[model samples]
Target: MESEVSRKVDFSIIRYAQCWEDPEILLEVLDIKEGDVCMSIASAGENTFAMLVKNPGKIIGIDLNPVQLRLVELKKAAFLALEYEEMLEFLGFSESRRRKEYYGKLKDYLLGETEKYWNENMALIEAGVINTGRFDNFFQIFRKKVLSLIHSQKRVAELLEKKNKEERYEFYNKKWNNLRWKILFRIFFSKFIVGKLGRDPRLFDYADNTSLSAVMSEKAKYAFTELDVSENPYIEYILTGKYTKNLPFAMRKENFQKIKSNLNRLELHNVSIEKYLETSEETIDKFNLSDIFEYISSEKYKELLEKIYEFSSNGAVLAYWNMMVPRSRPEELGNKIISLSETAKNLHAIDKTFFYSGFVVERIVK
Candidate 1:
């Protein structure tokens, strides 16, 4: 049976244009070995493709939303058909005026449905597919509407400037954290506003009761002061409209050819994780269950974990994020799954995506 959140939230459109979870942290925790089969939730298909760079034998990308699966197919076609620079340009990393022309070139590589979808939505292709998601639009609004009210272009640029720990902290405290910034940020990021505009309200059903805006504001502070803004792509995309200094793992130039070479290993399925696990014959060595627990009930979370454990091989790793609702290996499964809490904590400290409150990693020992 589908969960209430799943039944309520609209899935016909893309929720995330880019996977907000940090692939760096995911790769670190999963530690994929050569020839290992992996499974990942296909949100925008970024992290799933990122894993291909590690030379995994195969990667199965499962998503309940068919539109998201189309995105994965579209991205796969882009990697197969376009060169590195062209891929970046077509995917909205670099500026390009010929995205429609590029789409023409990629048509031969896409599946029938994917091709039809892109053909129908040529405007999204022309506007750059990476910036077309609802989440990306939310960031665009924050960048253009809310951010402009708080800081000028010069101040925003200064915020992104390379700085040491002491300098960054001082800058944030003295110049960046003004009263206007705080008030406007809270107003824009409040649960009600975010639910209506940024994300589906059902996503927050299991979210913490504390002020969502306040928690997010503190997370932003950590990203601003503690992390290196110059290399953080999430912050860069949120502040500016596009990536400049660093790109996500799948989009990096060095990994492009490698991912392209291993494109044969990628597979996409439009099905729930539970459904996929029930039918999957392969023993998965790593699972990138991207923050899906945040939307489901606690009972369903535990039930899904057990299903995953049944399909996992010995020493298989499971990594997921907690945006609001805290979830991890249940006590009943403690003997079967070993918690790697210390490793998760260390990785969470350096996680590039700062919005998530926790990153949990566990291993099947049996």
Candidate 2:
């Protein structure tokens, strides 16, 4: 028999350094207000910073992975210790040969653990923290090796310049969409590979068995052929390994001062959402769970939803993504957990990153 330690999954390492969700849709659905305390899962901490723009009283970002929370702390430290442009360089959003020196400057701002963590993993920091994680590394490989083979840099830039939707669709059909694109994409981004590298393997247990390649192909076609890829920062970042004009609010230069001013209001916790909720006495005004439900089990999801309901105040909004897995509140809890499926659907339609099968929004009734 396997030892308990060997059998248990360890999630303390870095999972994602960049968020894949569309913060625009989330902010629109949440409509966060002043004096509201928000709870969010700190997957790369992108949405956490996005949520801060609304001037919420507090935003607590909790993650099962300590390394992920460390990244969040490093981001906060960047704002505290560096200027707008310097912050970009320090976070690995831009090229800089002095990143190690910058890290040294910001070391005082980080917690003892966060500073020590960075010191130990200096190689990741030197390479650029935003580009070193499993998910980011996978995307980098996909972009450089897979995407570069099919579409030349000039061709992709030209496609983004196309304004007319009909013209873009025609261009994609004629110049881009083909059997080769589909086949290679499927082989590289398959569920087996994604689970092993991009996400936890158990997350795929409840994920749809249907061809992920097909699902991804459709999403890719929609993003590239139908939607304006220029405005979709997630796609742009995945393709180029960095953001230009379009970026998450956290990384944008204009928002840097605002984030720095409000950095004190944000808190980072290295704990599972369920564990945090069970121990905390705070009445959460909003919850951003991300796609964590897909990673756990149906029963676990139900149990956590119940805990969320218990901890929520009136008008508390909850948001999460349903990737390949389909998860919903049990009918027994329907009276308490009111479905905002229609609202979620509207947001999903306009989501910049159309990777997930569904985006779920719900409210706990008073």
Candidate 3:
């Protein structure tokens, strides 16, 4: 199979910020806080910027891909630098039947660089995100096309009206059960949503076909917070996409309401965790690896730790996670592994799905 995660970023912020696989619930497990310097992989720019909401001293978001970097730049541009409400309307925050108003809002805000990118990379903006200018009309057109093709036109229309989480859950579970599904999901959701959406490409990315199924199953069992909708409403909505039929909160402009004044604190980069550690002029108090090590091989896992150990001072706190795959880690790193009992217990107490496989690991620098 073509490796989808071959495109997976090293320290992407967007993936963590947008579709964290468990947004509203994973906060406790992440244990990240304000005034803390956080470093995360920038995937979609969502979590990279979202870190600002917590009032971090500095959020260093790093990625290698120019396209991903640009997208985060656009989110930062649209939110940090642009007019707030207009940015939201331009990026599909609320439901609107008035398509012209949606498209009109973006045309006004389109900047020079963003406009050039839009004109030149229209295909990317269609399949990807446009961070610089107004993307209202662009995405609206794209959304229409996707809905038309999915044969989900009315379902998409009805979904737009869902204003909050509860309504979204009800609509998906009982009303649009059929419409609430994706072929990808029917084939992969139960097993691979977390893996595909996870921080590591190795556990999900480099797996053998047989192992991929097991990875998917492990991922689904942990992330499937939707056992009974009444009991686990958020998980139900997440699994069904019944909630927030719109794009994720990170993509919405309203998130800036919480992050507006704190934008400058948002520092973005395009580098690996290793490269960032090697070259940065910063000391990180907290790190969210999001299972970064799951991507490394037996030999590389050692190198990953050597890099982490090089920067980590004794007793310095580190928070990341890994899959406990059979023989996943070589003995060298495993020998140094010290599971912070206090943090591990807290993760168990909190049923956040991303860290669901008891994926939270809090280790102090030895």
Candidate 4:
């Protein structure tokens, strides 16, 4: 088992507050009505809660990590038990003795299993509001282990600051080709970065790329990106890091109220998007999959299409972001399901460099 310190938080949770998401995007992608049941992944949990603001039939949140599940529980508990001001304060607005008081009073609202996690994690809380997200402060390990090792910030700056992608790409290839670079990567991760806050150290691993334990450990390496990183800690961090500073609003702190209100109708799950499309018993009226497909290769997309068909109705809507690679067309899934909008032919669009550079697509069930 890798240490939680290295494995806990990263870039994903940080930018969770900013990227393009929800109300603006979900309605476009999911086409979900006010009372529709919604399902989603609870990466940072902002969307899960945000969708609730729409007053859906229900909101289900799923995640592979107990940590994330716990985060959801905390968010929901906060929504159910705390006042708006206290909720804001607990999540990201402030750090006060009021926090201890809130935890003490809200004990009744929390589930039995979640109690222990809360009790222990409570001691770690501090002044920053950002500490309230899914994987707070965990990136400190990432910085100490990997970012710190970049020998020269000057070269790092030139590579990242270069305006042109082609030039940047070439520079990255040259920098990584040097033997010293690879050695640092291996060494920083060798023992997993140690942490005083918890018992275990942290190691580098992409939780999204993990499979069932039946597979070999090395098999997980398949997710490593080939994109050029140019030794720029930021870009390399973006390629390998967790949170992106640029995510949708639903992922942010400002809209947590919307997420809380819509909680009942939104369901967050830990399972893969492909799994839902395959196994769902009925065709949901709307489906919004942020760009999970980008993480996978083209061959695996069939599972997605087939599964989506099972879960959709003629009027059912499909929405997703097409990451850097051209979005995979479900044309083979047949013409019945087709694009309804040209601006949305790519369904939807957010004008920003998100963790995923992609287009939002909205497809209808024929």
Candidate 5:
């Protein structure tokens, strides 16, 4: 497999503090239970925290990016060191004038590397770690510069308040969705801009066959017209800078005690998925690999899948998403893999974060 260092130019930076996919839908499909040893990509650690609520026997999170692993460690430390309200304040969910002092307290619970990382990125903590990453920065530009010009804050908030799908569709079509909106949306999320600002340019090759702008437009339409935006934190954060009533499961108040109690269940590894799979002798019962396949070549993806198949236990379920780029198991492995395409389709219909073009779940039959 290609190393992330050679593949992504922005590997060192914090690319995402909050993941784009909805973990609620993901966990529904995951159907995790006790005694399950799960494997996941530690993107922002949101899904990992969600998995902990399931009371799994073990969860091994792997990430090639050190910054991403640091974020997870910081969160784990917050749970160990701070009270619920104080944890929220330190995590940027609420305001705190003494974040530095709070960090001083939290650092004792963190590893030396993780503490140093947060110490170096104190500005990010002060500004709200949720909105500080590069991907968030890209969205900030669009929200402030383009989206703000197209619609007023009240109008945008109103779009979230519609009672039903009919009401939403009517409001979106009549007031929000216009030629100007389409033109600006296309320009802002076009391949040229997203490739540079959001993700690496090399990943664009896999999505060359599809229209990136159209996928984005369709996703935007679904978020506005079909899904309930009242609790969709992804959209809430993108439009406004905060999560009011609804936050990710990891950050929610009720789940804090559960996460804190089960903190020992989660283990973090600063390594690639392939590396972890190769070294890990335990069979993974559930796999939550985000869109990592989108970044690699088809051959590399196939190789990685083969490794995953080897690491996974029989009947093990796996879930992943297709952002603009699409990927699937090689034809040669069809007999060993059972596709959950229909379930994926049904779940995709109600996906709160309509960012991904496709959602796929499969099981190992062999």
Candidate 6:
């Protein structure tokens, strides 16, 4: 039977055009060794492709939404068919008037359904695929409407300027964190507004009664002041419509060729994680379970962990984010799974995707 969360959230459309989590934190926590077998949630395929840069023996990307799987397939095809610059332009990272032409080159590489999907959505192709998702559109609206009310273009550019921690804090305190910014940010990001405009309300099924805006407001402040804004592609994307400076780990030029060369190691599956694990034959070495537990109940979360443990090799590591609802290795499963709390904490401190409340890493002991 489909879960309530699954049934309620629309899966027919692209929810996220790009993976929002920081692959840097993921790589640091997983510490993938060459030849490691990794399993990751395929949300827009960014992190999965990023994992390939590590030369993993194989990467299995599983997602419940076939639309998301198609997005991954399209990106993989882009890497295989286009040059680095062409791929960036084709994916909407860089300016290009020739994206449709580039897509023509990639047509042969795409699966039948994926080709048909893209062919039907040429407007998205023209606008840039990275900016086409519901979540991405939400950010676009914020940038155009909400953000302009709070700061001018010059102020936004100044916020991205390279600065030391002390200087950044001073700038934020004196110039950025004004009354208007706080009131507008909270109103835009409140649970009700976010559910309607940014994400599916069903996604918050397991979230507590805490104020979403309050938590997110503090997180935004941390990303702006404590983190290096110049080096954070996420901040760059949120403030600007595209990546103007640093790119994500997978999209960076230094790692592009490496990921392209290892494309054969990547695999995609359209199914739930529990379903995939139940039928899978491979023993996974690392798991990038990206914030999926936030939508499900605690009992369901523990049950899924138990299923994952059955297919995990001894000493295998699992990493996931807690955006709102808190979840971790259940105490009853302590004998089999050990929480790497300290490492998770250390990595979370530097996580560029600052909206998540917690990042959890665990290992299978048996």
The number of clashing residue pairs in each candidate reads: 0, 0, 19, 47, 0, 0
How good is model 5 by TM-score?
0.96
Candidate 1 residues lying further than 4 Å off, grouped into runs, are 1-5
Q: Can you give the TM-score per candidate against the true fold?
A: 0.98, 0.95, 0.62, 0.58, 0.96, 0.98
Poorest 10 consecutive residues of model 2 by lDDT?
A: 1-10
Question: What is candidate 6's lDDT per residue for 222-273, written digit by digit as tens?
Answer: 9999889888889899888988888988999898899999999998988888
Worst 10-residue stretch by lDDT in candidate 4? 214-223
Stretch of 10 with least lDDT, candidate 5 = 1-10
In candidate 2, stretches whose alpha carbon ends up further than 4 angstroms from where it belongs are 1-8
For this target, which candidate reaches the highest lDDT against the unseen true structure? 6
Displacement of residue 353 (Cα, Å) in model 2 is: 1.6
Task: Tell me the tens digit of each residue's lDDT in model 1 across 59-136.
Answer: 998888889888888889999998889989998988999898888888788868888888898888888889999988
Better model by TM-score, 3 or 5?
Answer: 5
Q: For model 2, how does the per-residue alpha-carbon lDDT over 272-364 read when each residue is reduced to its tens digit?
A: 776777789999998888887776667777878888888899889999888798887889998898999999998888788878888999999
RMSD of each: 1.0, 2.7, 7.7, 9.8, 1.6, 1.1
Candidate number with the higher lDDT (2 or 3):
2
How would you encode candidate 5's per-residue C-alpha lDDT over 1-366 as one tens digit per residue?
545434555568888877778888789999998989999889888788888999999999988888888988888888889899888888877777877777788857877878778888889888767777788788988888989889899988887673687888889889999888999999988888987787767766666567788899989898887887776777887887777757876788889999899989999988788777777789999999988888877888888888888988899998999987788777798998888889999998988778889999889987
- Candidate 3 residue spans exceeding 4 A from truth: 1-17, 21-26, 81-85, 93-116, 122-211, 214-255, 313-315, 321-337, 341-358
Native-structure RMSD, model 5: 1.6
Pull out the clashing pairs in model 1.
none
Give the per-residue Cα lDDT of candidate 1 at 362: 95
Better of 1 and 3 by TM-score: 1
